[model samples]
Target: MRLPFTHSKQEPANTRTARKLCWDSRDEYFRCLDRIGVLNPNDPTQKSKINANCANEDAKFDENCATSWISYFKEKRVVDFKRARALEEVNRNVENNQQAKGSQE
Candidate 1:
């Protein structure tokens, strides 16, 4: 089942990424429900149902609310991805240099 507050198919990718992060947070909002044995994690619609419910519970809940929550998670993920990308780039450079040196030898 879809979460109560989850966005519809029309929602943008950036919006989806943000919501996914919030749902994935340590607060375990989603995890708690999963561990409690309520919803199936494998179901794509579950998250949407949960989000929609959360949105309904709070009078202030809106697209912007989801947007803000998702933004924080998105930012953190982006930073982590950037760091990983940088490390990978460095490793690639080092490997290339080693290969070049080995060829010279």
Candidate 2:
């Protein structure tokens, strides 16, 4: 599932970073699906129906890849949140120090 590209200027930095990471993660699945020659069962060209009992190796691997992508984003979100928070804290400390120095002078 290819996500639509957004060109909105008002989007936040964290959002853009998360989106890029998610897209990159999803791309791995797309690449694996292509390599495995797995076609969507709904496609008109796919005459062989994939049944629940009939386990398709490619399909199973694709599902695993999807799960990996989800996990990547989950970890990425936590890291991004921490990073943004750390930056905010550093900036606040710097501002406070500058204010203190000005008051001392």
Candidate 3:
């Protein structure tokens, strides 16, 4: 299968790496499709129809790609969320400490 996009030096290192990883999984995904008898199209409409109804949870091609990307971003998101929460907590503590100091003064 041919991917529509090409890797470029202008892209971020993370973006390039993610693209490569997904492309690496392409062969495994194709083999899975083959085993499921969906690799070779009997009719073009069949492929489109399957795609139209496809779900990421189904673990098919779309599913695999979707989940892989989701997993990748989810990890990043989790880390970002944690960092944000930590910062918020630190700010809150500082505000509380300031309030306590102000009241004591």
- In candidate 2 the C-alpha lDDT for residue 72 amounts to 58
Cα lDDT tens digits, model 3, 1-105, are 434455331221346665666555554544444455553332455566445443332243333354445455435544755789999999999999999999999
TM-score of 3: 0.37
TM-score of 2: 0.40
Query: Global lDDT of each model?
Result: 0.51, 0.51, 0.51
lDDT of 1 by residue, 19-46 (tens): 5543545234434544545343334566
Higher lDDT: candidate 1 or 3? Answer: 3
- Sliding window of 10 residues with minimal summed lDDT for model 1: 55-64
lDDT of 2 by residue, 1-105 (tens): 445446432222345666565466455543443454643423445334333322354343334334445555445545766799999999999999999999999
Assess the local accuracy of residue 17 in candidate 2 as a C-alpha lDDT between 0 and 100: 61
Model with the higher TM-score, candidate 2 or 3: 2
Each prediction's TM-score versus the true structure: 0.36, 0.40, 0.37
Question: Which candidate leads in TM-score?
Answer: 2
Worst 10 residues of 3 by lDDT: 55-64
